[model samples]
Target chain A: MESGNLSAGEERFRKFSVYRIVEHLALIACFTVLAMTGLPQKFYSLGISQLIITSLGGIDSVRSIHHVAAAIFTVLALQHIITAFIGVVFLQWEPSMLIAVKDIHDALHNVKYCLGMAGRPAMSGRYNYKEKFVYWFILLGGVQMIATGFILWFPVIAANYLPGQFIPVSKVIHTNDAMLIFLLTAIWHIYDSIFNPEVFPLDKSIFTGMKKTTRT
Target chain B: METVINNKSGRMGVAAYIVCTALLVCFALPGQPSFAASEQGPRKVDKLFGAEGNADEDERNQCLKCHGEKGSIKKFPDGDFISTYVDPQAFTSSVHRSLRCTACHKEFSLQHHPERSFRNKLQYRIKESHVCRDCHKEGTIKSVAVHESLFRKERAGEAVVCTNCHSAHAVTPAVGGNASTGEEKYCLRCHSRETKMDFNDKECISLRVNIAELRNSPHKNMGCSDCHFGFSQENHPQRRFRYEREYRISSAEMCRKCHFDKYSKVSESIHYNMLSTGRLDAPTCIDCHGGHAVSSLGDNRALAVMKCRKCHGEVYDTYAKSVHGKALLNANNKDVPICIDCHSSHSIKNPSSSAFHDYIPEMCGKCHSNPTLMGKYGLSTDVVKTYLSDFHGMTLGLQRKEASKGYRPDPPMAVCTDCHGTHEIAGVLGADVQVLKDKLLKRCQKCHSNATSNFPDAWLSHYKPSLRVAPLVFIAEQFYKIIMPLMVVGLLFQVLLQIWRYLANR
Candidate 1:
């Protein structure tokens, strides 16, 4: 809303809300701690793993730290879901992150432009195809990790109704999803934000909650 | 002139023949007297048990002829009676039947026998026993400290003698002479006697052996000479051992001859190591089992613990207070291990050794993992299995597995003893859960220097993951299992679609 009164020479648009930015920061912090503590347990024999574990005071300390981080992450995720639900239902806000047919078209058009088959780039709104894809991936991955993490954390209670096999199944899923998100973040999200020529150094819009725009 | 020369040469040849015959007669005359003397019967004795005329018969037979009659007695100036008669039949049947009487009594001769003068028969016997060294050689006899100490000048009269054990007329060959029976008979001659074995008449040496006990031992069939090297009927009491310790230390050497493999293993044991450090009380072979009365090490497990308790009384007391030892005593549990089960019998190593450290987990696991065994005591058998899955357990297991392949894994992995303790393992069952947690926290802090109070909660404490026990962890694990594969496959398809679109446009 502040950008609405901006002069012609200097124009910008608001992207992320303060609430979203805070949530993102929380996610980053929790995810980093989780990876730092959890990955060592999986690859425990590595020298660096042992170093990290010992520096964190040992396996028990690492595990405690991991559980605390996981708990924080789960709470943040729940807050996000609650915020999204309230915005969509109570405030009559459009769920822009929801996938639509136009997103697919836009993806195709963008691919054509990348291949030099189109004269113009596909039009994007508040979120681009890449941004929507990563957003959805993060939401889905967070939900899955939270569910399985809770199962592993309270296996005795879960096994009351669920088959015994589910315990080990949850373990496998937790490990694989962890690796998947790590690879996705490294290869896709980092490349789009930091490594791409269009946003070479970094995409500062998320941090500042504003994006530069051109007025025609 | 030729006839005169031939007559002169014949006269000179006759004179040379007469001179050669006279030289032969002179040479034969000296040997003929002795030859004529032997042809006569046994020479007559002038004085009994005294210096007398020479005998014409064989020296051994001539001596035997005078002493051959039974019950022939001689009275001395001190009113002491001496038995001069020897049993000819017993002498013939003896192991030394082929030997001459003068072999042991070199001072005695037909013409000049030394006058025997001693306060007691033991003194005279000790004096005469010096003749054994002439043939036996001091170098050979001094191989044992017992002989060296007894043969010392100050101990001369008190020393054991050859004639004290071996009969003068009937000395037996040490070997191949009914050795087991002979060795027992010959050794017991001085040993079984209460008065004859008095050393310097000060300490009455009770060299008595319980023959029945010895005969009942596992070494019943083995001869005494088999173990007592350099022992013989002629040298019956090989050494007059002054100290029991010296005899025990020397006799242990004989065990190595038969139990070479066990001896070699024990040489590297902690017991042997202690001995090398000059701990006189440290156990040797005889300390655990009696030398002559050694019995079989039967399946009585408590015997080993008792043997170890003889020296390690304090450690045994601590162990007796432990859970395992209490279980053994209270429940009469044969399955419970004693000292040998963990430390081993002959090849015991120091507890601090790296090999012993690595071996602890598996050694504990041996019984702890047996479901049937643990179930009897209401203990969970999954302790080892659950531990192996934990981070610390996994590291230790990996290190252990790697070590088997000859890799010296990193030290200081948290093993069973690191938590439960090496000797003072208490019953954790029915203990207050919070107290146990506190104890575990303390254990964790040993390695985890910066550990918090909440750090111990991370350990599931041998509990396997189940829905009811760890519901959150179980659900989280399950959710990821399904979602991960779907996400991976879906993402892979999207990647492929993007690649195709780029390729198609190109």
Candidate 2:
């Protein structure tokens, strides 16, 4: 399976499959567009925000584009969870994205190591606690956005059965949650996956399908 | 000998040659002709002029060859070109058709034509116009009031040319009416150019009129004297205005003579109220309809809305951002309501008045009541029925009935604009709504001064009470629908019918 391959330059391990890379790329494409089109509407009075809206093709076009991107993201998220579940059940793939007691201990151990209380930091597996946290945060956030977006699109129909206040409340949450998810992607996800000293420069496994071999 | 011939002859002989050459050049110059020849030139000219002159119609027709060509023009460096290309048809058809060319032009001939210099065409025309006095005696010229005014202006150093108004070549017989519009040609001659007149308050107004605009206007069939009364060839009233505004207001008064119906309606308007109260900025007839640029606004009521934009610029901007405004302005959807669609053009009511306040709901209902218009946008036609069921609408309905019967009504009540907005109405969806909670709260505070954030919720913005939205209201309505009717019928039979049976048994 080429799981333990020594590349030309450095020792490498096969990590993300081609399909996994494609999924990541799809998520990135839709997430970037959703953030770009959605955030400006929340801060519409600003010149730069207005510029983005106009550059993206006025409010109507931007809204249509936003809905399309959100639909793509919703489909990708649903498939990601379902595929992970199927792989775990049949193909013996590890559910590494889930949190565990070891991950919690590893976090505490890492804190001790930082303060020089422990001999070394706790060892981790294919997916670390930081990575799992990011995955779960995004997966749940995507669901919330999808539910709220559909409600907003057909508000009158929604209000026929549900409370009308849910529409405005959903609107407010959608605006805020977009900003929250954007910051997580731009800062925490970027830092852990690329800028971290452990994988300084870039992780590159998401693109090249090879991750650095580490000692456990 | 060569030195003497070259030097002395080149000096003293050159001097003598120069003197002789100067004398010959001066005598040859046409502009500064020899005074003796000039005297004889005019005497010859005088002999050829008028009916008694030997120069006949044959001689005039002979000269028409050169004058008939359009290229026969004399250009002055400082001013306009003088066209010597007289229309032969106009001259032959003119009242002076029988006269010779020498009759008016006493200075020209085919052989002895002299080059004359003048500052401008006005000066040239003024000189030629003096010849008119030769045939028409002083008493005859003075008989015409306009002619007397022109003579006075001529004496006062103004360039009042007789040929400027009455063309020398195309001098048609004046119409017999005292002040006929047939004199339009006479007025158009001078007025068509960039003419101006000074008012008493030192305001110089453009007296120029675009003949093309007049020809295209609705008044094209009518004569100039029809509206501009007391002004014509025979009697030009010496009208005076204090300022340009006064002149505009005074000129607009002339429209009332013809359009008395519209004028009377305007007098009942708020604009007229302002005008009478010395608010000079108030628009009169000419302001909206325009003076020379007037055109019919027609059925596209949105086009007429632009006239109000001059004074209500910010209001128009707000309206432009609304759903109705966007439809009317951006897409040219004629079905959408515009400014004058609600506010009558001439009899515009004061919006702040209590009567107008009550009238606004009806005004909005004009279009909103149409199920086709409402359903087109997925808006509910039940809004009118729902609004009528509300507290404000019920009171407003009764108050209107009382007012119809000549009764003084109650205080101001809430209308469509109070909750929805006026120029900024964005349909039922409120597409531009940002923090509608705060907005609704503010609207609620207008009535309930101590209202909190939750106070507006009491109104419960539901078109119809659904179980999900207002369950309490829905339950109460269901109870009313089922129980209230049952109780009413039961009481009629149990109470009234039994009492009638007991009375019969007794």
Candidate 3:
């Protein structure tokens, strides 16, 4: 028995370009605009806000447009989830994405190997445990945003089941979480996936939605 | 190789490529597909026009047919746009009768009318009233004048927009049944979140507050618009509506609105009467109640006391801290003597009113003579009973005019201030010398310049015949206790001596 002949490893694992990074940046820009327009109106406190409200034409109009933008974001999230599930279930790839005890041992080994005490650490196939953790965190944060957002949007219904104080708490969580997600994606996600030395300027996997497999 | 490159396989490859491109496009688009509408053009203008009332041949022949005959009102239900009915008299009298309606209402250019909800893409798209100022450089809207005045008077920002307050089409009344009713309706429109008033996303809520509670107050009955000027029912700007000195209207003008009689009397009275000569010390209504939290003078006990305390702060603070204030607070009795008791509220005459002076002892008498109150402490009611019997009280009771002279400028004549230390009083045994003996001569010396030990006793005013002193009577009792017993013993001794001499001779 023999392993099936594989394509050249370097050729199959092609690096990402700057264009894909720019595209993600444009999407972030649109997301930021949506957040700006929505949050300020949510916390209106004066007459000038009425003018802003009127400029949007009305509250109902702003709400409708805001929901439309949110739907776009939701579609993006669903696509990411479906792609990850497909990668895990159908392809049977990237076993490091699973958080087994061995992954934690390998992570510690990798850190020791980087400090030059060990010659080399256990090398795994694709999707490091840290990246997997970040991906899971994104999914959790997205779900939290949607849940708390709806609660804030319709406080009267929320109050029927939840405590009155939870309304403001939900609002605080929603707003602060939105800020946190923006920060995490900007700092950690962008740095590691695109700007890190290993990637050397960009990663295209998020947009292209496919891995360049080495096996031919 | 020839079989693999056949037309069927080639067509299938092309179809696959096309489907892949389509799927990529769908993925990139994500959601809603939006497109910009056509840009609106400028309006049409008529070459020949005439005054509305006077129709030239062009106006009569070209315009009047569909617009209705010469003087009749034109009721147009349809064209390319919604039919607008223009009154003939209004058009004729208007300043722009020489120009056709199409000149100003630029979008209504077509023969057929547009839908009811059709936005006039031309005229409505032009900038707001400021845009009009571009061409009409010589003219100014009345709102500009009002805005300037508001800025100067209140230092406020523009609250309502120009269009919210004024109409370009016609002179709209401030109130109407179809639109806003008055200032209230206008304010409520934007203030309510339900209404489309707050255009700027300012959270102006229509909090239902009562103005009725402020009636009969000093600020009452003044026009609300006078203070809240430039404030419309529409989306108003958030300005801090303060009652500062610059925005302060004269108290006399405010009071005269309702209290003409009171204003007239006060104007002649010392407060206003003295104010005209540049005496700035005269107190206004604000000085007492303070303009903001002016409560009812009749019912508000705190307000009533605070009013007096404003001018007489030092005296009132001491008075309230005294036993009188404690009694008044505990008992809720008006007879416990507040500031107004000694100095009347409205009719506070000079400090020398016989009713005021005569009532001093009587006012004190209320507490002293109440057996339940004073008797509990074993205190005497004779203070009131004998004060009335004293020469000073009798003099005050009989000849109030002459008794008035006694209370004139001197502390010695036995006014309430004489013994009570005016504001601070203590018990007779307490440290207050005026209440005690130390300062008795000093007070008595005010009227009787040479008063000494021979002067009329100060303690005798309320003196009762208990174990306490009465100079002459106390001396007589001392002599009977000591001297009379010695005299009796001396007489018995003399008798015994004479008897002894008779026995020796026998």
True contacts kept of each: 0.07, 0.00, 0.00
Interface RMSD of 1: 9.2
Choose the strongest candidate by lDDT: 2
Candidate 3, residues B1-506, lDDT tens digits: the string is 12422457544543333222111111111111211111110000011121333344354334446554434432223333323334344343222334554455444444634433323422232323443333222222222333334334324443333333332322122222122334433433222323221122343333332344445456565444444544333223343322322123343245455556756666654556545665556566556654434556664454477677766789777766666675555666554557666554444544544455556777677678888787765677878877665435543443443343343322323655665655555445346634455466566556655555424353354665334545443443454456444544543343343234334334
Docking quality of model 3: it rates as incorrect
Chain B TM-score, one value per candidate, order as shown: 0.61, 0.73, 0.45
| Model 1 interface CAPRI class | incorrect
Ranking by TM-score: 1, 2, 3
Considering only chain B, what TM-score does candidate 1 achieve? 0.61
- The clash count of every prediction, one per candidate, is 43, 0, 29
lDDT of 2 by residue, B441-492 (tens): 7986776565565445445563576688656556555654565456445433
| Candidate 1, residue A211: how far the Cα is off, in Å | 15
Span of 10 residues, lowest total lDDT, candidate 2 chain B: B26-35
**Tens digits of per-residue lDDT for model 1 on A1-216?**
466656777577778889887888888899899999988878877889878877776665677899999999999988889989999999998898988888999988876776668865677778888899888888898899899888677665565556544555666677777888876776678767886555669987788888766544
Q: What root-mean-square deviation over C-alphas does model 3 reach?
A: 48.4
* Candidate ranking (lDDT, best to worst): 2, 1, 3
How do the residues A145-213 of candidate 3 rate in per-residue lDDT, one tens digit apiece?
777767656555565566544554464556656655655565556655675544546755655543444
Q: How close is candidate 2 to the true structure, as a TM-score?
A: 0.54
Model 3 chain B poorest 10 in a row by lDDT: B36-45
State the iRMSD of every prediction, in order shown: 9.2, 32.7, 52.7
